[model samples]
Target: MSEALRRDYRVCEEIGRGRFGVVHRCYSPESGESFAVKSIDKRLISEDSVDRQCLYNEVKVMNLLTPNPNVVQIFNVYEDDIQLHIVLELCNASDLFERVTNRVFSESEAVAVMLPLMEAIAHCHSHGVAHRDIKPDNILFDEWNRLKLADFGSAECFREGELMSGVVGTPYYVAPEVVAGSEYCEKVDVWSAGVILYIMLAGIPPFYGDSATEIFEAVLRANLRFPPRVFHSVSPVAKDLLRKMLCKDVSRRFTAEQVLRHPWMTSGGETGSVAVLT
Candidate 1:
């Protein structure tokens, strides 16, 4: 085998698969560091323009992230003529989807997770990185329940001291400015983080519909709702904070730091909210 093809990866088992490629648990014999190997099929890209550049961007961006406590770390990159390989640190704990699919996050559970979630997002913003995609799948918990933000494929950099423009992010979580074709910036990331917080507390996303248009419409025109069941034990201050974070207007949403200061964020009670990213 070629030296590159002869890597000492254990190739444990398949953990994820998407249109672009497959992800597997792998480990290095020399370092003994666990890694998630994402192999993208070159066939997935027809033209070598923006798509290919994006593939490369994922590599470059991961390299640039500060070694913050919450951000996923990229360890190596490899490619054959037919496939691009990205190997990243494996966050072995369950993700938000797993938590939700299984149902329930006790108040203490929510608080413990949110603290790290906010810290990570704050760190990303401080580093000039925007996690354009925020949803349950992206959030993960290690055995210690430590939160780590995963997946930077959709992350983008804003111009220095400049906000962002155009639409980017999951449909339900996209901020109003992004959805309305107005200029947006890092605050959009805060909006997604809020959505994540809501999910952790409440167990479901605030916006949902029969179709994408309907869901987007709900996000754009509807008020985010919280139920009494969710609020039964949650404090008024926490609900008030949720009201602020999930606000429809991008300008109106609470910043990650601001949300971090919310009483509930510290107290750790939640009823419902948006999904986590993978």
Candidate 2:
């Protein structure tokens, strides 16, 4: 543990660790409240400026998030000569991947995830932020199974109506415009969300292969199977929603707002409110 750790909070145990550093489960002694502290060892620099820029961008985006139920609250940020710390709400529940392993989600439950997810994405879009990486790992569930979008490490901010040009994000969830070497906008994030929603309903991704190259080819071709065996009870309406969401052209795909009102999503939904301004 760093000597700079807040003495106000008792560092409990290591809850998570990865390339960045370690995340400690911490508890506030005064209020008996628990939170996760994300520690990034900045001293161990990556190979290029891109990695440093990406880390700094993540910090900037997290700092800009507004108070919203579906968004993870970044409580504090502090750093030392060797590490940068991010304190966040600690929800020790399972992720979408874990849920999918046990039970297939009903259309109602899928809608529950979709409504908040769409609203959160819209909030990001409205604030000129693009969460370039959207996937099951980045979505967290609280005690009530409510959804929260986490990890803005791959986010980019664009000027009014301007699109960014660069290949970013995970291969399986990347948008066509991004894959095709063309400039793309917020719709790219929508594409990734569609893939996530599709996985939630169907219990697997639309495109898959043994290697990254094959998966990229499938996404580029929009190759997929209808009525996948795992999705036996899913309705045609849900399938149609997925098709529209995964459209190759970002322009033709559903906007975050349009996705909120879609039949399969709104027919069984609860409205949510979220803001993304600093």
Which candidate achieves the best lDDT against the true structure?
2
lDDT of each residue in 1-278, candidate 2, tens digit only: 45656776788899888886888899888899889888888867664768778877887887787667887888777777788888888877997667766566767788877888888898888888889988878888877777888989889998778989889889889987888888898889889988987787777788877898898888898865676477656677777778888998677898887887786676663221111111
RMSD of each: 5.0, 5.9
**Worst ten in a row by lDDT for model 1:** 269-278
User: Which candidate achieves the best TM-score against the true structure?
Assistant: 2
Angstrom error at residue 120, model 2: 1.4
Error of 2 at 36 (Å): 0.6
TM-score per prediction, in order, is: 0.87, 0.90
What lDDT is reached at residue 269 by model 2? 30
- Error (Å) of candidate 1 at residue 89 is 0.7
RMSD of 1: 5.0
Report the alpha-carbon TM-score of model 2 versus the true structure.
Answer: 0.90
CA lDDT of each prediction against the hidden true structure: 0.74, 0.80
